[model samples]
Target: MEAQRDRLVTLCRDAGIGQAELLADTLSLLLEGARVSVQSVGTEGPSARLSAC
Candidate 1:
């Protein structure tokens, strides 16, 4: 998880995002939530809105 976060931060920074850390954290949480949603409610649930986020 730490490695993934670090990589996300690095990618965000490379893209010149001002709040790289925050964005990385938000993306991590969003992805985790989507994964859990998919498992609990199937692919047609809230996880399907991920592309809209």
Candidate 2:
């Protein structure tokens, strides 16, 4: 997870995005939330909307 986050941060930074760390963290949280949501409520639940975001 740490490695993935680091890669995300590097990618964001290379793309010249400001607050790369924060963006990576936010993405991580969103993904984790989606995983939990899917596990608890199945793919047809609210987690399905995550792809629309």
Candidate 3:
């Protein structure tokens, strides 16, 4: 998790994003939620629907 956070911070910095840590954390949670949603539901779930857009 620490390594993932560090990588996210680096990516955010490279992308010129402000509040790197906060944005990384927020996006990480969103990804995690999407992953769990996909797992619990399926390809027809919210995560898949979001990816389609």
Candidate 4:
């Protein structure tokens, strides 16, 4: 997971995102929340709603 986060950070940096680490962290949390939401409330849960943003 750490390696994947590092890779995401690199990608974000390459894309010129100044806050690459924050982007990576946000993406990680979003994914984790989606997974948990799916487990707890199917696909159309709060995470899915949040992702629509």
Which has the greatest lDDT?
A: 1
Candidate 1 vs 4: which has more TM-score = 1
Worst 10 residues of 4 by lDDT: 42-51
Q: Residues 1-53, candidate 4: write the lDDT tens digits.
A: 78878988999999999999999999887767776887789867777776686
Alpha-carbon lDDT of model 2: 0.89
lDDT per model vs. reference: 0.90, 0.89, 0.85, 0.85
Quote each prediction's TM-score. 0.74, 0.75, 0.69, 0.69
RMSD (Cα, Å) for all candidates, in order, is 2.9, 2.5, 2.6, 3.4
Give per-residue CA lDDT, model 3, range 1-53, as digits (tens): 67887899899989999899998998888777887898889978889966876
Compared to the true structure, candidate 2 yields what TM-score? 0.75
- Which candidate do you rate higher for TM-score, 2 or 4? 2
Ranking by TM-score: 2, 1, 4, 3
